[model samples]
Target: MSEWTCAGPSTEPAYDPSDPQSGRALVNYHLRELGIGETHLVRAGEHGLRYCRTLVPEGIGVCRAYVLTEAAWPEGAELCVTVSWSPTAELCRNHTTGAIPTGAVEHWRQRIAATAQALRSVGFVVEPSHVRYSPVYHSDADLVVYRMPEGVPARRAPAAADWALTEPVPPNHQRRSWTYPERSPEDIVIQALRDAGLHAYHYEDPLPSGRVGARSITQTVWPPEADRCTWLTWWPHPTFVRDPGTGLLPDGAAQHWRDSLERIREVLTGAGLTLRTRARPWHPDTDEEVHYLAYRVPRG
Candidate 1:
């Protein structure tokens, strides 16, 4: 994914003292210039903020544009805009070149330039130096962080551990199933492991066909175990698959995964685990994105 940021001096507060509605008008004007139609006005606290987002379809790829007031900036310098694009799995799947989609960089460059110009037209002083473009990894991943309870020590080696985690292919049932199962496969796996009195984490292994499945699972058994913890990832393969005829996944698939993940996070935290790092890394095998939440486990 690529990200571009532009910031400049705010000519006027989002709220126009002379006419309260003028603030929305000004925001709409700039957003229209950027071809962003859907806007949400947030009037909370002391500031009036306008948020706009749009998807721009460019040569075999799609980018998202976001415009909003920089609330952290002082009243005089609060205007900012960002545009970003990370190719979706569908786009990558349909890509014919067998490489990263071409022309994405140039497309974003042009769009960034246009956005900066639009901000300038609105009386914000956007400078060339203020515009920046850079690569962003795992742009679609979610993150959760927490700290483990104090006074717990790392686990000690035993002749045989209670459970073993391995990166195994999605079972036949999961591979063929097209409907949302009664329970999340990952949650079921974790519960089974815990039921058997084991401490473990699991992730999906990247498949050779540029696809991924529920595969990676492991006991926290690595050596040199310290206060730090390994990263745990939940790749949403089942959620990404589209329904047979509709060309879309079930409604709320993404939200369902989010809620499941949050539940898992809560469970881990309740178990006295501390999160150290949350990251999204492109899968080494499939080149697809996955999110990882890392937590420190109290050793025995």
Candidate 2:
């Protein structure tokens, strides 16, 4: 590159690319590019295309980062890039088993796309690559990101980057019992959804005598925002609230609930999880309807 040589003697303590005054940004880039996993002497005038040979069109594993030149890259390899997640306490505790979902993946994807467009504006060819999640993703995972569009002043972009993990209201914060078998998919789903920046909780039905009973969580994942009904019947169903004057539900709150469900669906599908919604009547006296959404994994 204009900053430094693509083929050079691989050396330790590589130059920092951020220091523009160094005028040798590619020294470190060359070292990292050629030494992915291990070092191979990059011959001068090699054109830097050999590194892309490992990419498979039908790659079926966890994502890995590959560097490619900007000059009209291999057609099949330029998959749109997405970024990985920032670590959380619960995330690190689980060892990233199964898939971890985050809105941040798409969040940074747009940033990279914007940066690439900025490069094109200044007369440069910018090609991106693909990325995806896999089953049982490890903590230290690989990712592909785009370079900043050069020849621009220092400016920042606006984003919403907060993962506030509040305590699960004490009564519902109980562990699973040994009576049932392995960890359920719903358990994993809640974790993935939280990592994706959605607030999800588990609510347990209390005992008959209003006492805290052993944790037997049976699909207790109704989001309060969506299931706007606050009170429920003795049976584990909502008391159908309606105005005596009009058949419409009270306060027009279920509309807000529907909006929340739509937003949650977008986040789930983005993370490659299946979400299904259904409305069913749950009253002994009359037909009263309740809406619910469920996360489902393909039967395998």
Candidate 3:
């Protein structure tokens, strides 16, 4: 039930990425991978492993633990782990953030040491890897298949199907829940969310820091994505997308975000807030023309 999530590969020989699936089954796969059995976990070992109660476990960690994915493949995505240092408390002491003061520099050093020890305990070696940190959070970790060491053999591969036999599969259900501010667009937006089979819960972005032009507001977000929402924020005006001045989206992640955004868009336009766009700023760094969508809100 924690906000942290770490994703490891599905690793199910039957899992096909082209048609990805997540839910309780993946959770079982991970528990077996970790060699632990706990209906719900507070923490694992002294360090942590990922786990979470889920409509499906797409490798989202529960509490503050990491999810175990496909053993460790050599030079594979799984082997490349990213360690992030929490930002300084002075900057992140706001309620919107759970900075918890990542604790002094030594604390992070201990974190690295402890993490390395835990991994080694479980047969993972600390090969060379990159390190980076931001003002806060990995709220995200992508996993890949890892290669096992030469001298030691890897643990027996566990199958989700086998694990499910021991653990009863819950009756299938969907959490198409929705809650939103009583206002324009949201009312219309709810319909799209329900249609998409996604949930909508209210979220409060940290109040704007005292930086120039910082804007924050209570908003609603869907499915695991924390922070700003594109729909409500673009209310008064602002549409966004790749450059070249066209309604086009490249495949993969970009298209996915746009598709989600468009869901709310079609509903709003249907409700009569016509979308309008005039200008798009050049990329702040790359100078490419990426633009946000703009729209004209209805007159009261």
What's the lDDT for all of these models?
0.35, 0.32, 0.31
True-vs-predicted CA distance for residue 169, candidate 2, Å: 30
Model 3 per-residue lDDT at 107: 44
Q: Estimate each model's TM-score.
A: 0.25, 0.22, 0.24
TM-score, prediction 1: 0.25
Best by TM-score: 1
Clashes of each: 12, 1, 22
The per-residue C-alpha lDDT of model 1 at residue 170 equals 27
lDDT of 3 by residue, 146-171 (tens): 33436655444433232212211111
lDDT of 1: 0.35
Q: Write the per-residue lDDT of candidate 1 for residues 198-291, one digit (tens) a residue.
A: 3233335322111222322211222122232333544444545456686556666555455545555565566555433212223223322344
Model 2: ten consecutive residues of lowest lDDT: 227-236
Please name the candidate that would achieve the greatest lDDT relative to the true structure.
1
TM-score-better candidate, 1 vs 3: 1
**Candidate 2: misplaced stretches above 4 Å?**
1-183, 196-248, 278-300
Shift in Å, residue 87, candidate 3:
10
Q: For each candidate in turn, give its C-alpha RMSD to the true structure in angstroms.
A: 19.3, 21.2, 20.2
